[model samples]
Target: MKETAYLLQAALISAWWVGLASNGVFFAAFQFDAIPSTAFWAFFAPDVILIAALSTVRAYKQNSAIELVILGAFAYASLYCVNATVLTASGYLPTGLMLLGLAYNGFLCFSDSAFRVSSTSMTWNAIKTLIQTVCIWTMALVIVPYVILDAFDTFALPSMDIWLIIGGLLFACFSLLGLTSAFFMVRDGAGTPLPLDQTNHLVVSGPYHYVRNPMAISGIGQGLAVAIIFQSVPLLIYTALGVLIWQLVVRPIEERDMTRRFGESYVQYCRHVSCWIPTFGRRGT
Candidate 1:
């Protein structure tokens, strides 16, 4: 059963990458108002480079199901970018293809056995996480800024300045860091970052050695970066509120759960690491 699941996942990911590359070529062709066959190769070349780069990273090995999911997500996003760009350029929507791609991607994500738990439990947890992500991101990035802050009229996108570049770099770095932290939970702790499938072991290595909640830092950092890049005060306020809520409500509950699960080992780790601030040179627990 496990081998079958692995094979299915591999096939889905392979299909997703091929679709993504083809879509990129279509996007380039549309942008240039031409459909030269060479455009396909041009787009495919970058995918080859990207795959090679991912291959060099041990975390992205074939056995790492979660890492493969991450790569699949990137491919899915690339397809979306191509679709969106084509639509904007031509003022036409590939609604059927878009829906099909979305359904297929959703199937790939849910069908994979990323957790050791029962299939029903994993599906439930994944659905919960998906809903939570959509809600949180929409509120922070869209609703708060557009509806509440009147961002459409109040703020404009920032010019391509040093601050904008810095914000982009920070967002990219923190996003990767957060994903890496989650990967560690899966690889080292034999679990996930979700509360329902919480890590079994105390993750003291990687970013956790420096700070208690690197994931939260990454979330807040990305939010702040987006706010700065778009010059949206409301988005910045939303980001701050998110951090405050996590610190006040979420962190306490998570710490309690950790203490209950890990007892003295977690307590010792907490004593050594700061909650938010990164403390270099402090010996890890």
Candidate 2:
């Protein structure tokens, strides 16, 4: 039975790669206006392949409940890709591409198997993290600026000044760095950033060697970058407030949690590493 399952899974994986490749070709053809309007069938092929592959892999690997949830997400992503392709055909190409990009991000954030979380516990934890992300973004980007600062009244896009362009480039670089840090946490520490799924190992390498809170710095840096690009005083204030909140509220709580979890090792780390600033020559525990 296991051999049969493995063979079936291998076939499904092969088919999925083929479908994905075909989708890429179709997209290229569409870009050059070489494909007809009825090319939606090409999108469906990949969608079906993704679904079949996920199902077969789940069965062959004996996926736990959390694993099943992850598989479900991939299935949803495949469906969303097909929907996006249809929307592209309908002339909303940018929106379609954005949706596809979001799906890809979701896949990156949730599909990994590094975190040692059980199925029952992970469901609620994942949902909580999702809600927290939405709330934080809404408050920082929308509520603080539009409602409190009334930034929309004086809204204008950023001019293509050299400084603004520099800010934009820095924003991209920092954003990528932050994502790499998170990926390292998962790969090295076997955990997600959420408290509910915190790492088993103490991660002292990579970005952690430079600073205590690279992710937080990245978050604040992104806000500053946006403010700089827009040249909005209100957005700048928003970024400042975000930093203050992190310092006054979040840092303390996280420190207490880490100390409790890691004890003497974490204390030594705190002593060596600066909280917000990068210390280049310092060795982290």
Candidate 3:
């Protein structure tokens, strides 16, 4: 369901906020939007609107689209303005949250009804997934670092591009892997990766031939690469958290879903190829 993304985003962002507040700067000094200020209330009101938009938003509905555009467009813009001029230190928090929220919205825009719907043309699947990929990559690779750089003034890395080069190379490789997996899912499986429109058939081709989850592997690797490139401990922790979530929470649900959907075929496939880890001598490719 599209609500899943919003709910997940809200939870992740809230955790991020709590971590920052409890660890280093509990509402850093020199803030322009401190409590009891009209400026604070102004930005706060927009945040509420942003939250409300996420709550009420639905996918593929013209009215929902219009509402999101009107409310989300202005609310995000207003928050940007405030972040630019007023908020200084912790200000970057809003920027990062907004960008991530925008990334989620990109997914919300393309997928149809919350639950799995009828199959769509491969073209539509490609388009929607492309938008989602671009938004997610931009937010994670670009926007997240920028926000961290700004907010974490004291958190400095070496003034060298060594890590950047390494991270960039690793990110590129995994991104290619992810894209290749998506392509196979679309071409062979006849669907997009969005839960709202999952693959119609079991996709055991291309990267899936070797690994059960090239995308998950790619995502984890890319996340680690980003953290390494930036020399960011926080990002490293984030990568670890991602791994735990995938292994503990997401993987179980997804595996159960796959079993329910595909039955014996999926179980047999799992028996052959390992999930992410390469079992080269397995019976099936």
Candidate 4:
């Protein structure tokens, strides 16, 4: 069953890749703008729908931590895609390709099997928390610091496009959303409330009540926001691609893992809450 699940997931992912490659090639050949965003959504939406349809018959085991970490990488790649696309569309050929390559490599590095496994549910969620730690740390220690230093020492507001500024605001909102989930994970232990090597606990605090994968949502939001900030067509496309990839790879893995880890408890949660968005009445308070 596990093998079948893996194979099915793998096949769907491969199809998505093929679709992306085809779209890219078609765009290049025709000298037209390749809206990979639409293509990606179109190609993978079916896979998601199909998987969702079949999940009722047999639940797939998943790894939440692994999926979240990969998602972080997906967010990074999405940023690159949008940025690179913009450069390319703007007629900066070599630079565009370079950014494009960078985005691809970043995603490739993070999407390996080793990086996609969380042995226990607690560990799976903890792994996501750890990723947030890394991201938030980088934002605090590197990106933010650099931005601030540049702003203060140079006496200049960073050269940001209006889109990028918008992206930044979006990122802030999403990052906060992710942090909400992260806090619950930290507070509970791997599954929630603090770091632990052991897997246990089911979190129902902070952002969990509002959504299942707030961190994933935040990561995606940040990616889109960054794409806007960069205003890069490639980046934006990549952002869309990233979301598709997350829906394809990360979400399924987490869902399966959580379902297995929590069983009826998770089943109950699924009934009451959603995987990404909130239930109709439950607001993120």
Best by TM-score: 3
Tens-digit lDDT track of model 1 for 78-153: 5754665475553122322234334433433443332233133444445544565566557555554554333124
Model 3: colliding residue pairs = none
Clashes of each: 0, 0, 0, 25
lDDT of each: 0.58, 0.58, 0.66, 0.51
Model 2, which residues run further than 4 Å from truth? Answer: 1-152
Least accurate 10 contiguous residues by lDDT in model 1: 90-99
Give lDDT for model 3. 0.66
Model 1 error, position 249 (Å): 0.9
Cα error, residue 133 of model 1, in Å, equals 7.2
RMSD of candidate 4 to the truth, in angstroms, is: 11.9
Give a tens-digit lDDT track for model 2, residues 88-163: 4532332333344344334323433322432334444455445655666565555444432231345565688986
Give the range where candidate 3 is weakest over 10 consecutive residues by summed lDDT. 26-35
Tens digit per residue, CA lDDT, model 4, 85-146: 57556323323333443443343334333223224465566666677578665753345333
Could you tell me every candidate's TM-score relative to the true structure? 0.51, 0.50, 0.64, 0.49
Count residue pairs with overlapping backbones in model 1: 0
Candidate 4 Cα outliers beyond 4 Å, as residue runs: 1-132, 135-161, 191-199, 283-285
Query: What is the Cα-based lDDT of residue 113 in candidate 1?
Result: 35
